[model samples]
Structures are given as C-alpha cells and as structure tokens.
Target chain A: MLDMIIDFFVIGAKIGLILLPLILAVAYTTYAERKIIGYMQMRLGPNRVGPKGWLQPIADVIKLLMKEVVVPSGSNKALFLLAPILFIAPSFAAWAVIPFDVELALANSDVGLLYILAMTSIAVYGVIIAGWASNSKYALLGSLRSASQIISYEIAMGFALVGVLMASGSMNLGEIVKAQDGGLLHWFWIPLLPLLVIYWVSGVAETNRAPFDLPEGESEIVAGFHVEYAGISFALFFLAEYANMILISVLTTLFFFGGWLNPFQGIPFVEEVTGWIPGIAWLLLKAGFFLFLMIWLRATFPRYRYDQIMRLGWKVFIPVTVVWLMILTFMIKAGVGPWFTGRGVL
Target chain B: MTVESVVFYLFATLTLVGAIGVITMRNAVQAVLCLVLTFFSAAVLWMLLEAEFLAVTLVLVYVGAVMVLFLFVVMMLDVDYASLKAGYTKYLPLGIITALALFGGIYWVIRSEVFGVEQMPEPAKHGADYSNVTELGRLLYTDYFFAFEVAGVILLVAIVAAISLTFRGRRDRRGQSVPMQHQASKEERLRVVSMESGPRQDGQEKTEKKKRIRRKKGGGS
Candidate 1:
C-alpha cells in the first residue's frame, strides 16, 4: 500500500508539473503578447487592472468564468460545447512529447516529432468546428480559410523536418539534440540553411501568425472562426493559439538550434558556471527568441491575400523544399553530410 | 485473459464502436465527433502494438488537423438533417449489401493466413535498443529512400494541384497587396502627431469617433 501510494504521488506530481506550467505559461503569454504589441504600436496595454497588467490575464479569466455561456439557438449544441475541449486538450497533450531538456519531458516517446506534428495538426479541427457549429457565416468562412492554410503549410513544415531528420538520423527529439552536440558549427542550421529558412517560414504559417493570419484577419471576417465565440469559449481558442505558437517555437529550437546545448561547447564552465539557471531555461530562451521573431513578423508584415498565401506555400515553399530534399539526399548518399556516416537519420 | 490483454480488447472494442458510430450516425457533426473518438481509441490500440509513432501521428494529424477541418466543413454545410433521412431508405438495400460484403471479405482475409515457421514468442525483455521507430527510419532512408523521395514528390504535386484548383483572384475581396505593403516605411504608417492634431482626421476619423461612442455605451451597459 505504501509503495502504491508513493507511485501514485510521483505520477500525480509529474502530471501537476506539466499542467501547472502550461496553464500558467498560456495565461501569461496572452498578457505578454498584448503588452508587447501595445508597446510596439505605441499604446499602453492593460495596465489599469493590475501592476503593468501582470494580473490582467487573471482578471480576464475571472470575467470569462463569471460570464454565462450563451449557446446559439440554431446550432449543433453538442459540438458547440465539445469544440473547446477538442481545441485545448490536444494543445495541452502536444506538450507531452516536447523534450524541454535532456532529462525533462512529460512523455519521452521515440516518435516525438511525429507526435507533436500530429497533435498540432489535430488542433485545427477546433477552429473548424467552432466556425461550423456557430451556424454563422463569418465563422464558417474563417474555419474554411484556416483549414486550407494549415494543411498547405503542414506539407512545407513536414519536408523541412525531413531535412532535420536527415541530419540527426533520429526521429526522437532527444536524440536529435544529442546529434547536434559537437558545437554551434556542427548544428543542422550550419549545413541545412535552406531547411532552416523553410522551417521558420512554415512555422509562422503553421501557427497562423500575421502575414499568414488570414483566418483571423480582423478586418476581413471580424475575428474569423471565433467571431461567434464569446467569454470562456473564446478564451479556450485564445489558449490553444498561444499554446500552438509555443509548441512550434520549441520544435524550431529542437530541430534547428541544438536544443539546450550551450553554443560555446567544450568549455567546461558554461552550464556549470551558470548552474543557477536550469537546463529548461536554455530551451525556454531559444523558444522565446523565436516567439519574439513571430511577434516581430506580426508587427512588421501585412496579412497576405488568401491566394497569395496559397501561392507562397505551394508554388514557392513546396518546390524549394523538394529540390533541397533531393540535394540533401544526394549529400547523405555520397557521405557528404555534416555528420557523415552510414546511418541515415532515423 | 491478463489485465493487459483485457485492456487491449477494451480499447479495440471502443475503437471499432467509435468507427461504426462515425459512419452510421445521421448527424454529420456527431459523425465527426465519433471519428475523433475513433482516432483516440485507435491511438490507444497502437500503444498496445508498440507502434508509438503511428499511434501519435494518428492523433496529431487525423485528430488535430484533418478532423477539425472535417468538423468545420460538416458543421457549416447547412445540411438538411431531414433530407439525409429521406435518402437513407432509398439506399438502404444497397448499403446493407455493401456492408455485408465488406464484413465478409474482412473476416475471410483475417481468418486465412499463409503458413510460416513458428513465430518467436515475445521475450520478457527485447534486445537493447530494438525500437520500431529506429529500425523503420533506417529502412526508410536507406533501402526505401527512392520510395520516400517519390512519395514526397507525389505530395508536392498534390499540393500544387490543390492550390491551382482552389486559386482564383477575387476583385471584390479586400486584401493587402503584399509587394506594395512590404515596401511600407515607419514614416508612412506612424506619424508622431502629438496625440494630436488631437487624433488627426485622415481617413478613419469619423469611424473612430463613432466606435469610441459605441464602446462607451457598450461599456456603460
């Protein structure tokens, strides 16, 4: 009984560790976006509610909780209720596969990259369902646009990952990072510059960031698929979006930037000298830098026309990735890869 | 059966039931939800098979992206629930015959297997690093690299086809001109006008004033 109790507690504690940080990070991320955008646009963002809007997300939570959920009269009420769960659950679940550090991850499966991709992809349904179930025209149009955008970008993203997988020879994120551990120069980014560019662009498009953010383009569809959503329902959608952004950022770090590997390698005093900072901090820092770029892109670029977005993904990204994939294959076959060996990236 | 076997059966049953629900359900939205259940239970089954990659991919791709799109389209279609019921009786005999044939064929194939050397029983512990993902990856990029590359090219072609089929310019649609927009400078977009000209009346002045009043009213209410 004592052993069982200890096992349950350990498992429960691990579950808590995953859930608490995710929920908290998601909540704060909203505040960070608002504040950052506000600063960039030259306006004060959410300062009245709490200290520099630190507690504003908390207030938003309270408001969402207190507000009565009003289901539209002529909607598929069952799906209407379930859509939020479908959206948020997969966003949360995808976190399980992300290896924050060598030791720290919720569930370290061998197919970590595939698992994350699959979960992130499934999240689009929530947006689609929200738009459809609302029985509203704007929502439907938004969802349709989102579906096409996500599916198109996913092809580019997957191909980009093919490049990373070739370099690493492993599908496991942990193993991928381990493969990148010689130094900064040895990282996949040095040799696979094309894949890096494609991955980053596709990452922006995948997360539905600005320039590619036609789905929620405020002027076009009045908040897109979530237009009919209000209160907590809207909040769930918000959480999912930010969660997805974080997931993509982490993936970019893991696949491209030798995740958690301090760039100044062979220096014994690097991580140990900075031992006050946890390994998870390095992962977070890399992820944060990418997140900053995402926000910067949002601030910098105008939303692309729907056709233009499609053209960019299909005509440009897909072709470029395919050609590079051929080159990478040839290099790997000829033993010209950065870390040349008989083993292809597993 | 042991606990593991019992659990496997439970998940398998759930997956099959969920799949059946997906097809038979009258409500299109309900069908999509059942599909989600089907994906989830199938993932559970894949866990039993030690095929974590395929299982997780099933959840991530099918559950996350594809089904979401499916649900979205299904929900927005303005589907006439009554019209669907009208067609069901008309096609009932054809459907029944097709279903029976499918089931029979499936059972026949499942029951008929080629004789091979006696299968090795799963060891209490497999050899060090016997991961399916690793072996699969090695096999794919080495011996199957040509097929993998071809599959990629096929997907690329499919993507091009999908885009071309859907791509059409709409003059009525108000969207940003990418080249013209990208050429924008800070000076053009933001003018440091002292709050001042007291929020200058360029293009959006009247609209902004109206919005401000409406926001005030809404906030007050």
Candidate 2:
C-alpha cells in the first residue's frame, strides 16, 4: 500500500511536469500569436503589461477569474457548466500518450494514436453542448456548423493517419517515431508527403483554426458556440482551443517530422556536435515550427466559405488521402526505395 | 475489493444509470446525451477487460462519431413531449410485460447453468509486450477475413444506396464550380475595349452641359 501511494505520487508529479509546461506553452502561444500577427500587420502587439508583454496572459487569466460567470436564463444549467470542462479535459488528456522523448510519456499505451483520436472526437460534445445549452440561436448555428465541419474533416484526418500507420505499422506513437530513426530523409514526411499535408490541414480544420473557423466566425455567427460563455467558463474554452492547436502541432511533429529523433543524424560533423542536444528539444523545435506555420497560415489566408470548406474536406482531401493511401500500399508491396524497404509494411 | 473490480463496479453502475437516464429523461437531447454516456461507460468496461483496441474503437466510432450525429439530429428535432408521454400510462402494462420478456430471455441465456464462472473462466492476463491489436489483426485477416470483407462490402453498399437515394442532381440548384472558379481568367471577367479617342458630338455635348446645369440648379435650390 505504501509502495502504491509512492508510485501514485510519482505519476502525479510526472503528470504535473507535462501539464505545467503545456499550460505555459498554451498561454505563451496566445501571446506569440498576437505578437506575430501584430508584426505581420506592421504594428506592435501587447507590449504594455510586463517586459515585452510577458505578463499579458497572466493578466488575462486574472481578469477572467475575477469576472462573473453569467449563466443565461432558460439555459440548460448542468450542460452549460459541463461544456467547458468537456472541451478542455480531452485536450489535456490527449497529451498522455504524446512522447516528448523516447520512453518519456505518462502512459505508453499501445493504442496511443487511436486514444488521441477518440479523445479529440469526444471534444465535439463540448462544442455542441456549449452551443445548445447557451439557449441562443447564434450559438446553436455555430455548434451545428462546428459539428458538421468536424465530422467531415475527421474522416479525412483518419484516412491520413491510416497512411502513417501503414508506413510505421504501429499504433503506438513511440514505435512510429522509432520507425523514422535513420535521418531527415527517413522521416514519414518524404514518402507520405501528401498525407502529411492532409493531416496538417485536417488538423487545422479539426481545431477550427482561423481559415476553417466557420463555427466561430465573428462576422457571421458572432464568436459562434461559446458566445454565451463568460468569465473563467469562457477562458476554459479559449484554453482548450489554443491547447488543441498546440496538440495538433505536436502530433504533426511526432507523426511526420520525427518526434525526438535528431534531423542531423548521419550528417558527419553536425551529427557529432548536435548529438549532445536532447531529443525533447528537437521535438519542441519541430512542433514549434508547425505552430508558427499555423499562425502564418492564419495571417495569410482568408476564412473559407462554409460550403467551400466542406467541399475541400470531403471532395478534395478525402479523395487525395485515398489515392495516396493506395499508392503507399503499392509502394510498400513492391519494396520501393529506402523508405518502404525494411520497415513494417502493414 | 481489488482495484479492478472496484473500477468495474463503478463503470457498470454508471452504465446502468446512463441506461436508466436514456429511458427516463423527458428531453430528447438529454436522452441522447445519456445514451452517449452509456456508450462511453460500456467502452470503459471493455477497457477493464483488456480489450483496449475494441474499447478505443467503441469510443471512436460510436461515442465520438455516431453519438455526435445522433445528438445533432436529436437537437434539431422539435419533439412534442406531451404527445410522447400521452400513451405512457395506457401502455404501462404492455411495456412492463415486454421489458420482463426481454429480461427473462437475457437471463435464460446468461444463467449459471449455461454461462457462468465454471463455463467461462476468466481469461489469463497477457504480458506487457502482448499487443491485443496484433493478435486481433492476425485473427481478423486470417480466420475471419471472408466475414470481415462481407461486412465491409455490406456497409459500402448501404452507404452507396443512402447517397444515391438522397443525391438529387438538379440543374436548377445553383452550386459553385470551384475548379471553374479557379480556372477563371481576368479576360473572362473584364474585356478592355480599346477605342480611338474622338471629338464629342455637338448633340452629346449639349446634353452633358444641360445635365451639369440641371445639377447646379438643383444644388443651388
């Protein structure tokens, strides 16, 4: 019993280690987004709070905490309160299987990939419930949009992951990363480039990020589903969204860009020098790049029209993934090149 | 009790509660939500059995995808609770009889003589390296390949039939041709007609002057 308690405490501390940094990252991501977009628009962003606006997210959090949580009259009180928790819980929970470095995860579940998928899928409930329980037409419309959009893109996203699974032949995230051990060229991104792009794009759409954020289209639906949410209740939804963005970025890094695996492997002098740098650092760098790319995309593109978004997800992305999956299968069967040579085919 | 049994009992109780909630809740949306809860609890129970693949797939396919769609439709529906409840008292005896019949049938199948601890002993726990997915995959592809393919084909046929039934390609319905939009050129949008500069006709000049004077008079007024 004493040993079990100690083990429990150890796990708790490890979870804290993952979550604390994750929360900080999510907070800073909002700051970075503002600063980045501000710079892109030829203006300064929140450089007013602390040194270089370092304390903006803190202030925001405090403000949200102090504010009153106004539950609209006639709203489903239970579900209204439950929505934010539902949204944020899965976003945080999906991090358990995400390998920071080799053998550095909370639970090294064999079905890590599917677990994440299931968790993400569950997040739709939060959006739907938030929208419905708000007892507002706009919120309902937003949730409806969100529900259909997520459902459509999820198919494409699943198919893309199927390609990754075929290439790596493992549902375990660690195994997937280990499969890409040789170098940068050995990464799944090269052979499964289309799938990677699809996955990244689908990830963006899945998170309801800028271009595909029809669910919360400010002009169209006035902040969409969580419009009725206030104070910390609202803050939870915000945290979930940003955290999900980071999650997508990290998954992209893991699945395609080689999580924790050094890109400088087999590069002679560079490899020797960079070998000392820890695997977690490489993982963070790759994930950060994708995060930056997501922001860059937000700054660059206009929000897609609702029908266009659906068309892209269903007609374009789904077909592309299917075709690429077939091609990948054929390549694996024929034993083509360095990629499909010795790796687990099916 | 052991931790596993405790967890099992907790989830089993939740499953029962959710099932009860599904039947008892007046609101359609609430009922659907209860159903989702039931599905999720059932999946957790599956996880306790160490059928991790099946558990996750249940959550993914049913709770995640199917339940969301179910909730979507349920939310959209304008259910008349009064009408739904009108026959409850009238059908009470019939409902109770049907329920009893279902219970009796289930009990008969699962009773101690046929399917109990002696008949179906607990499965041996596998090692840490034992992948349930790998074993399942092997069994599925080799032993039940034909059955699995047939099931997949049936699902495909249903999907095709559903799509065909609903898809109406009406020429009247205005839809954007995205490829055509992409292929659109500046020439198609705007034609720059180069015209030689010429002196204005006396009649045209007079009309222009009259219009300008009229505007001036209107402004003055």
Candidate 2 C-alpha lDDT tens digits along B129-162: 9999999999999999999999999999999999
What is the C-alpha RMSD, rounded to one decimal, of candidate 1?
8.0
lDDT of 2 by residue, A1-346 (tens): 6665676688789889989999999899999999999999999999999999999999998999999999999999999999999999999999999999999888899999999999999999999999999999999999999989998999999999999999899999999999888899989999999999999999999999989999999998999999999999999999999999999999999999899999999899999999999999999999999999999999999999998999999999999999999999998887776777864354
User: Could you tell me which 10 consecutive residues in candidate 1 chain B have the lowest summed lDDT?
Assistant: B114-123
Badly placed stretches (over 4 Å) of model 1 are: A1-9, A267-277, A333-346, B1-10, B57-95, B111-128, B137-221
For model 1, residues A128-204, the per-residue Cα lDDT tens digits are: 77877888888888888988898888888888888888777788889899998866776788768888998899888
lDDT for B163 (candidate 2): 100
* lDDT (Cα) of model 1: 0.81
What are the chain A TM-scores for all the models, listed individually?
0.92, 0.98
Q: Who wins the TM-score comparison?
A: 2
- Native contact recovery (fnat) for each candidate is 0.81, 0.72
